[model samples]
Target: MKKIFIVFVGLCLLIQSRAIADEGMWLPSLIHKLNIGEMQKMGLELSADEIYSINNSSLKDAIVALDRGSCTGELISSEGLILTNHHCGFDEIQTHSSVDHDYLQDGFWAKTKEEELPNPGKTVSFLVRVENVTDQIVADLTDEMPFAERNASIQRKSFEIQKEATEDTHYDARVQSLLEGNRYYLFVYETFRDVRLVGAPPKSIGKFGGDTDNWMWPRHTGDFSLFRVYCGPDGKPASYSEDNIPFQPRHHLPISLKGYDKDDFAMVMGYPGSTNRYKSSFGIDYTMNETNEARINARAKKLEIMKRYMGSSQKARIQYASKHARSSNYYKYSIGQNKGLSALQVIEKKKNIEQEFATWANASEERKAKYGKALELIESAYENTQDESAYEYLVETMVRGPEIFYFSYGAKGLYEALKQDNQERVKTNAEQLKTELDDFFKDYNANTDAKVAAALMEVFNNNVTPPYQPRFFNEIKYKYKGDFDAYVQKMFDKTLFAHRAELEEFLNNPKLKTLEKDRAFQSALDIFDLMSVLGSKMRETKADLLTGRRLFVAGMMEMYNDKKFYPDANSTMRLTYGTVGDYIPRDGVHYSYFTTLKGYIEKEIPGDDEFDVPGKLKELYEAKDYGQYADADGTLHTCFTTNNDITGGNSGSPVINGNGELIGVAFDGNWEAMSGDIAFEPELQKCINVDIRFVLWTIDKFAGATNLIDEMTIVK
Candidate 1:
């Protein structure tokens, strides 16, 4: 009751305050109680129930969580025409692509429903309901309870509640903590598995400007892909089958060709992955120096090696396209975030806020009792875990960096199965491993991986101390004579995992001794053994850090009742609204809210993969075939900017107008605000979206996929 009262009062205060432009990733279920009045004042034409309703068809019906929340997508037609970002579907596209067909380079368009490509394991989910369960969860907790005990009780209660709620349904339920465990909510979702690819533009359009313009504004990338949801004839979730039919959605979004103007109301609803808006200054410092820095450095090396191979071979280019993009996207983002953290003086700002909070806490004995030790605990935890930087490097370089080493880690399951001496289970596991390896090797290049292994191994040796070095390094020093390159070459030569034929032969003649002697497998075992030792040593400090953060967050909320607060994103569906506006990132640098086809043409560099404009697109531009998708000024809008709060998983989220009509697809955030995941910069943060009109133009005119265009409800 106390926790509920605090949240309720917070909501009342939030409703009375003037709203900031790009501040929150709000829960949709609480909109009427927390945001509707302000939203209506900002030009919203729909009621709260119209946006989110469990018992009726509403805007929430159109939205789907792609692949259980790696990204977001929307139903654009009654027959389940799903629209999501190209990168979100990059894996599926790559899996289906071949050297001869090259769907990635040439694109694919299913003229008929029968031609749509089936994607196994791919799924899209819709939120069925969000229920407040704070009172129920806290009913068993007391203020004097120990942290571990309280956490255990909460988890036990949440499991019981979720199990009971989802007892007989196909729906999935998760109990997520809000306000850092002070509040709680249960989100229920209905997931569909039989999703199929319908259409995609070539990389020349879909990934225009490629890595060079990934998180940049004034962009022209047509980063959209088409998929469809299929279900059983009875209209329930079903496995992939030829017998499955396209799902008839309860509601689908009407795309508005009525383009938005600057300052026009905009709202985005999607699963935002994460944000640490309440992070302490010490935590921010740790992220800047240790986590992000290690990631950026490690990924940079891998990207360079991948780019070298990709640049040389057309096959390698297609194979590693998605891999390179994924690595580079965050590599650049980390660099930008470090710069933003420094340039924005975020640490100083955080310190000032901490000082203010401390002053207030010390002013009252009760406040001091609650919050006096929060910041101290956070600082102590950070200090105790200062040595984690080396571990982070090991994780980034040894575990996540080298392709061969990572692949070898999978052998642990096989090793365990072999020990069981169950011949039937062994064969079953071998076949399963073969299937996984087939998928892995489909886009794998051994030459590139060998280079990556050598480089990253050397980096690990140089950065980490002698005591911390994995046991395998001693082999390189003693047996290989300190030659990592030679060792890697021999491993690739002897390891059956490197080649399918060799692996198939080994699987047929199963032997535990062979795996034990294998250099690649041995290295994986050494790393795993060493990591386990180090992980145990670090566990206590990590537990302290988590507890400190939870307490610190609670303290802030309790002490600062005047300021409105929103919880950090945790890969749950949220709604954020603002306006279609631009910002001056710095002095003397004002950017427009929208970009047009002309800017795209001017930026094109022929024969260059990153900025190459397809000959057909160039011809279209020359002929001014803007069609009905163009603005009144006769310019085709490519992408636009909005000061809407969003993050990584918000990719492919529908950027809707006040009328609940899809106007654009949110794809990227401005580079200037890369630090937004840690701290929201209301003035600088902007959500970059691909104009829905451009998506339509590419489908109807450029791709000649009028059948797709005919299915959607297009509002002029």
Candidate 2:
């Protein structure tokens, strides 16, 4: 039977490559050919060219990729500051918050460098190299072509290898696709764009347990933040100037304050973003019945109409505090990833690894014509969950639940330049929608999006299926007869895209019958023509589910050719490593890896708004004051835990150690591995960091800010 299923997949790949040493995320330019000799026998005192070098300055230039990969920052000094996580600069501290500079309820310190703030479309990037171009993108493909002609010949040889690796560099490049497209790399980067901010703390100390301790654990939140970057006078990137400067980094992360013990080691490097550890089980039963049940039923009625307009004040809580923490961080991460994929059965362990790859592809006929219909073409392209459950309930109720149907679908490019009459392309798309109506009416509130468009149009007309509704739910069931709050209060009282001076006086006289008699631009053109007919019927079963997931990840990499695989997270820049232990998550329940400031004053509740507590962090925890950033058991620790393998763009990632320094920032994961981005529960995953001495004891003793503590290089 194909040599007894290749010696039962080489004894299940030698017991999953020796029970994963804190599983992989790797690729720091293949850590000197696959993890510097098992990270130098698990201690790794640097060297993989000092952690990735394209000819110098290493630790991948102090890891960045914030807005680009959506979170992860480090560069701890040589002036470009950085440090990341306070919910990844929670929308630039809720865009420099207001009720007279609230900085998300009191917090913000710049102390100089002209009291920092500027963050116009923030960016950070870095990376600068990584090659692999998988044999020049599968050298003119085959296996009889077509999967949209081998994805347009791997997107025209990845746009000619990212235009010859960024011709005449201002560097950006791309490529990506690893292991599902069976490898390819490139990367490049640089970015910058004046990022600013500088410091933050008071969402009760960077969001202390709000959303009742997000992704739980012994976490005490001080979830970091701070920023810097700048640049200009020939250093490079520019934009928000005033004659910029600070950008002097090629490697920064120093700050250790000598700490870390339980199995020490550790490591991280950032930009994690996505992970689908080889998906399947019909894509985790269509990601738990259609995209985490339509983002936990349209973000639980748009977070109860944005917590009733952010409790009707503090300027609607700084205009929906970063849109209610980005829709309650994935509506409680799809209710804890559908209770950790039904408590980790993980769709019966991906249906017993697709029934041991369909019994070793029907025991040969040349592996049954090269992997027989890869799990019957991924179970006939996920056996119809009716157009992927009405395209994930029209992308969680009208393309990411109300904000007036994608801001009146950005006036369909000024209604296709006023139906091609094109007066200079309708004055350049009406001066880019009047310069995006001053950052969309500065965090819009049209009555809290008209009660989130009448509670997500009654959760998409009682859960989709009227042939995927959206003819504005048959004009709200025949002209408001079904009311939906009087058809969303007469589509927000006759939408000139919900008044910002009547959409800048109808974009200074725009017409086409007043945008075809607007009602939020004809319900944003019937919600983008039913999202272009359900994205042309899911790109007709997405080219046979991308040729059965690139021939089932190339027949499980030629049936585990001596194991060693990695590649899933796609935001990119990887490196994982592990240690600072702690995890028992079950039976006798032992949890602690770290957390103190006396468990953030034993999770205080004085006047609770998710466990409040900040009378100057309860007067520096009743004066023990933790000066040299404590922790020799003297206390003040805050957060920690590791066994590394992170996700969600390794939120503010840093947690270094083995003499690489920095030691903690990674923000949240535990809750018994919220399906660790599709399975990698090495004993209930972990990551959850914060404690770099509770981020320098909240910038030197709760915001004394001591000129941002003498521009930090602090290793002591």
Local distance difference test, each candidate: 0.86, 0.83
Per model, state how many residue pairs clash: 0, 2
What is candidate 1's lDDT per residue for 639-681, written digit by digit as tens?
Answer: 9999888998999999999999999999999989888887777
| Per-residue error (Å), model 2, residue 368 | 1.3
Candidate 2, residues 1-716: lDDT per residue as tens digits? Answer: 66544333321221134456767788898879767877778888888998888889888899999889988898888989888888889888887888998888888988897989888888898988888988989988988877888898899999998998889978889897887788889898989899889889888878988887898898788888889999897889888879989899888988888788898889898989898878787888889878888889889889888987888888887888888888898889878888988876778756767777778778889987988887788789888868778878888887888888787888888788888888788878888889878787888888888888788878888887677887777877887777798888887898888788877887888887888888878887887888888889889988888788878878877876766788888898898887998889889889879878877888888877667888887888898888888988798888889888889988998988877888788887877778878777777788888888888888888888888779888977
**Candidate closest to the true structure, highest lDDT:** 1
Q: Relative to the unseen true structure, what is the C-alpha lDDT of residue 30 in candidate 1, on a scale of 0 to 100?
A: 87
**Residue 351 local lDDT, model 2:** 74
- CA lDDT for candidate 2: 0.83
Superposed model 1: Cα runs more than 4 Å off: 1-19
| TM-score for each predicted model, relative to the true structure | 0.96, 0.35
